[model samples]
Target: MRHFSVFGAAAFACALFAGSASATQEPQAADILFERPQLEKLKGGDRLDYSYSFKSADPSLFGPAFDDRIGLRVEPGDGPDKKKVEVEMFSAERRRAAGPFEDMSGNPLLSLMLEENLQRLAAIFQANPRYMKTAIRLALRNAKATPEPSEGFGDAPGWRVEVAPFKDDPHKARMHGLDTLTYRFRVSEAAPGEITEIAISARDAKGDVLFEETTRYAGKH
Candidate 1:
């Protein structure tokens, strides 16, 4: 499962969509990205084009309290705007990990492998479109809160995720000799297309932010 806990915590959401006009609603987190028209063409097992950038971590944050910036880029399947998008690019950054892990940097080979693995993951994600729905479903199953119903548009209401510090290492202090850690994300409402807002946390599991930051979507093309 390749760290399903971390992936689940980070990749929760990204599977909701609705074209029907409604009212003002809250946004939900997503594991995949897609445009309105692209979502329409989905058959239960269709793949989607997806791209995203992770926020570079500032060494200063040095803890689960540090903010993790994440961006999602989705290309529609086949429609008038199949190549276009509703939100175009959705970006957000929030704290995810509070403590430091074994920085494989000490080993040049391992560091290189990390980079290669990341690229491999990207290639696999793009080649296999079914990953979109699979990622979202996995995230939802791991979320602490249940998904909320949507009212209208904007930020589809009904999704929230909460994270607790690690039981063995509450402060996430590598100095404290921490072991494995796990956090939780609760779903309140689900944003269909773009992730309008997210309030997830990272810690030793004590509900503390070694780093934290909130971001907004600029609807950038």
Candidate 2:
């Protein structure tokens, strides 16, 4: 009902992997959605991590479901006056992600978390991640977040924003039947990263789930 702000750590994507991206403008929410003071709220000696899970209705088509973690390390800011964060998302790649971040004064982990998902979808569609990213940007631009219980680790008051960017896409025919895909984001100040949980899924004509992925707060670990 009201607006709010959120993160979880991240890496750059070609430009998306390394450059910056942004969403709709709503105040507290967009800040949490894209920019946040998590780094400012946090300090040296503070770290945060989230549980990452991937599940696709058809593993053979979309890979297998697995568990992972996204971690953030508070360190000296890239500039003289602020604190910066380093992210270790995929251990194999040893990637460090922060989206649309020009500097490291604030939390960029949330940006990373979201970009990661877009990258995955891009890969599935054999399209550019940036192309898929546009959907989210459009969704956030027209979004009206709904009030909800800060689920997962954040029990504080929160908001959930849901969008189906592909629902009306004229290019739906080429999306591997995933044109109905939807994304749900839950965020609150009570959580360590402000992000409570994120869910992405798409169903088939039969109403069976086709794919699903989620990132949730698992508490300090």
TM agreement with the true structure for every prediction? 0.32, 0.76
- The runs of at least 3 residues in candidate 2 whose Cα sits more than 4 Å from the true structure, single-residue gaps closed, are 1-32, 78-81, 92-102, 152-155
Tens digits of per-residue lDDT for model 2, 12-51: 2222222233443544334445555545555565667777
Please give me the total number of clashing residue pairs in predicted model 1: 39
Candidate 1 has what TM-score? 0.32
Indicate which candidate wins on TM-score.
Answer: 2
lDDT values, one for every candidate: 0.28, 0.63
Report the CA-based lDDT of candidate 2 relative to the real structure: 0.63
Candidate 1, residues 18-83: lDDT per residue as tens digits?
331223253322221221221333232222222322221333333232222332233433443233
Cα RMSDs, all models? 14.1, 7.3
